[model samples]
Target: MTSADTWIAAAKARADKRAKEGKVNIGTYTGNVKADDVIFSEVVKPSGHKAYDDAVKTIRSVQQAGFVVPPSAAAAEFTKAWQDAGNRVLLGERKPADAMKQAQQQAQQAIDEATQ
Candidate 1:
């Protein structure tokens, strides 16, 4: 379970070594090829694992819906602050508005630091 490019690179490297060893067949995970959908695509409609296939569909749907955001350096800081604030609110230790205001300042600070 890696990206297609990574999987292809690793497979090629292993294939080269196996070819040098005079092996004609790459061993299947299961004893039968029909059971290994990742290797033999004809055995399965898409990815062998249902979870992976579902994830692909979900990602595609999200992309189509324009719910994606570009990666940012301030994201980590904002995530930490937001999670802390959320937890405090859940525990009745802070008001939602106050917690959010503090989290916003922290995220702004992170952005300022990155820009400097």
Candidate 2:
């Protein structure tokens, strides 16, 4: 299996475990937490790839910066940032490092703007 597949499997396992424990919403892992939070915390584990790791860290940082619950524009920005990075990487148009760097900057900017 590919690394992404491995990650997905691991996440599914975690989600199932969480569900069994009643920590997750029935039929979904996104329970009381934001989907990104679940993905960052439970889905994206360290895979020994520097770029992937950095991207995960960037995502976590943004999520921690109040991108969770929101009528906040920051949340929208975070979504865009994530989609841009993921799309670039998936399309092989950019290295994960490059994509994630841009995403990090955008997400941070959004947080700053939202807080201001």
Candidate 3:
């Protein structure tokens, strides 16, 4: 539901407040929070004509070449990723645990390979 978006945003705000109150690891979507209840966006490969990929290339290159944006260019990078992903975006009901598990698995795989 669209209301979830507002709630999640509020939760984030509260978590930030809690952090200011010396609370760490207590995020709005941390416990019992469903991913489906949060904003969701998936990037799909764009068609040939539209979409700028230089930013993505740059991000990968930055990761590979050890680079960091100087804040001034951060917005541009975010914008590019959004645009290049064919502008296909959705927001709603994203459970925190599922996302975290998938991310952890991917990271674990990468780490396993790196050590091997």
Candidate with top TM-score is 1
- Indicate whether candidate 1 or candidate 2 has the larger TM-score: 1
RMSD of each: 10.7, 13.7, 19.7
What Cα-based lDDT does every candidate model obtain? 0.59, 0.66, 0.41
lDDT of 2 by residue, 17-98 (tens): 8657855322222222445455556554565667756765665556444534456659888889978999999999999999
Deviation of model 3 at 61, angstroms: 35
Query: 114, model 3: CA deviation in Å?
Result: 63
**Taking the tens digit of each residue's C-alpha lDDT, what string does model 1 give over 6-51?**
4544555555666678543242233222333343343223435577
Better of 1 and 2 by lDDT: 2
Better of 1 and 3 by lDDT: 1
Residue 51 lDDT in model 2? 70
| Native-to-model Cα distance after best TM-score fit, residue 87 in candidate 1, in Å | 0.7
TM-score of each: 0.41, 0.40, 0.23
